[model samples]
Target: MKSLETKAKEELRKAKSDIFSLEYQNKKVWVKKARGTFSSALHKFYYKVFPFEVLIPVETKTGKETIAFETAKLDLFREKGILSPKVLFKNDEFFILEDCGKNVNSYIRKRDITQEKMYYYLNLLIVQLALIHNNGLFHGGAQARNFTYKEGVIYAIDLEDSFTNIPLEVLQFRDVLLFLLSLTKTRASFDLDYNYIIEKYIELTNKKELKQSLKKLANKISFLIYLSQIKLINSFLGRDVKGFFKLFIILKKL
Candidate 1:
């Protein structure tokens, strides 16, 4: 019997293929069979982000096995009180997690993102992030598509690159930027001064008095906004497709 960790490592092969291959028609989905090289961490990401069809169970000639939902990692996340897609199935070396119901990105792309409703949801998103980080984990890849909303509440997903010792400053900068970036895509890019939208949320959410959070949010993006054209590039969809690789290459030497 293969341990769940072993099966998860095996599934990580070709993470990008699975992410792009997930097909959703109405509420049903068909996921591609894993057949390429993707890091185990990223495979964990795909499983958390999307629901998939039941495929043949994977068993090695040596008698190792893979199963869904019952994996140790899933249990760990659930036990921590973190919000993610609910697990649906598990059989040797495979698992299916729930879908977002509706994407958070779609809501951000709307015309009137500065509406009070938008601010309310965004602040709620921020509080959820604060709570998750307090539990000793930070979602390294904080982006709009990672958050989801259904009914009147917000849910977070994906936990592959989290850090247990995340600095409060870093977490504040990261979470604030993600929320701001969503607004930028919808409004700020048009020269609308949307800082008030953020300020209002901060005012309403009676937490640990987020003054430092507010300050860092500005400082982090000061350079990006000055060179907004450059910082504005989509992390996933770059002009060169692999343009981020070149940017990272430049960054590594500096």
Candidate 2:
């Protein structure tokens, strides 16, 4: 096989192609250009060491545009003992992460897919989330897509809006909201069999606690908190922004 450097260079070139390519995971990823300054020499240097990159994520892990941010989430994943792609490179402008393949969203949406397999993947995700929360780190983005499954393993991805800073609530909301978006963005309108999702989510979590948490979350916010909360709930239910905004506007009209 080619030397590791040669392999990475080959990978980097692939990363730079098109808006981006999804060769890292199954349809997982590495990363491409920084949004604004990538064309600049200094920004490239700066992003080289950044921890995560803002992205235009698509059917693959990355998207047409991306921005890099510096953080220790890579190490956090390693330290917390979560399954993830390794971060092989970093700079002010970009950081290279291991490729996790097509996410659980696709798998879950595949219809009539086995519950045993889905639960197996979800169990991994829940365990990882529990561990991260215990350590004061938040996934910031948790959803089916952020995880990749191959053979029988799961890998977590995306962390541009992430933080280890927390009362745990911050992390919780971020992960919950983003995951909902992953479903919203990736699946079709009719693709979501929401009750099925709730069944799965409930399987991995304590339904009583989740219900109580939702009540608490809404109570602490404005009277319209239910609407905002629905943003996440609908997303998990596979309802997209198009549908969500329409519903939000209707509720506001009410």
Candidate 3:
């Protein structure tokens, strides 16, 4: 019988997608490959033009460097007591992670899940995000899609974003905004009380600068908020703009 490492290597050679799942040791694991050079470059460029002080983009890497960076981030998150996927196997070309479970987005869209249960899961996510920020760390992509839920615990995944050369408070503030924005994309957003969610986060987080950052961001985007209310602009931009307007209105009150 071939070792799991050997099987993984063989699978990698035949793999077409950058990320996929494989069975190993009678359990499912996920394999991730580095982005191509062009894709990595474009990622860097997108961040370069991002119009916020909170998102200070770093140089993006590809191939072996990308794999190494992500692996290091996973290890760091574990060290900080944040729940993340355990790296079962890794190398320059690719790495494999123990299966966590379905993302919160899927749960939000499930028709059978009660509103109370959905709120419970959302609270878990918010608490976990608070814990991560309180630990002097920030999730670069703190979206619902990047989080997994299993056995009543939410695990943060997609730990590829780098927080280098950025203020910790700024990065953490960005994480909060990204998380709230992601919730707007879900069907449950309509039923959610934006004020309650924001207040809960404020109550849990010890970051004194967070409210200040929120105030600053709200002022900076006041024009965008006004435009988002316009029927013409809202139609073109969709629910995202409306969601932002709603969330920022609550933030502005803080």
- RMSD each, Å: 11.9, 9.9, 2.8
Which residue window of length 10 is worst by lDDT in model 3? 35-44
For every model shown, the clashing-pair count is 11, 20, 0
lDDT of each: 0.47, 0.50, 0.79
Better model by lDDT, 2 or 3? 3
lDDT of 1 at 27: 40
lDDT, candidate 1, 46-92, per-residue tens: 53554211111112221112222123444565688866666544444
Give the Cα error of residue 110 in candidate 2, in Å.
2.1
Point out the higher-scoring one by TM-score: 1 or 3: 3
Question: How many residue pairs of model 3 clash at the backbone?
Answer: 0
Off by over 4 Å in 2: 1-29, 35-71, 163-166, 180-210, 216-254
Candidate 3 structure quality by residue, lDDT tens digits, 1-254: 77768888889899988888899778898999876332246556766776675455654566787778778888888888889999988988788999999888888766566778878988999998998988887887888889999998999998776655777777778888888778776655345676677778888985556777787878877887778778887788756566668787776777
Error of 3 at 180 (Å): 1.1
- Candidate 1 Cα errors over 4 Å, as ranges: 1-17, 20-74, 90-94, 112-114, 163-172, 187-254
Best candidate per lDDT, number?
Answer: 3
Leading candidate by TM-score? 3
- Worst 10-residue lDDT window for candidate 2 reads 51-60
Q: For model 2, what is the alpha-carbon lDDT of residue 238?
A: 33
**Candidate order (TM-score):** 3, 2, 1
Query: What ordering of candidates by lDDT runs from best to worst?
Result: 3, 2, 1
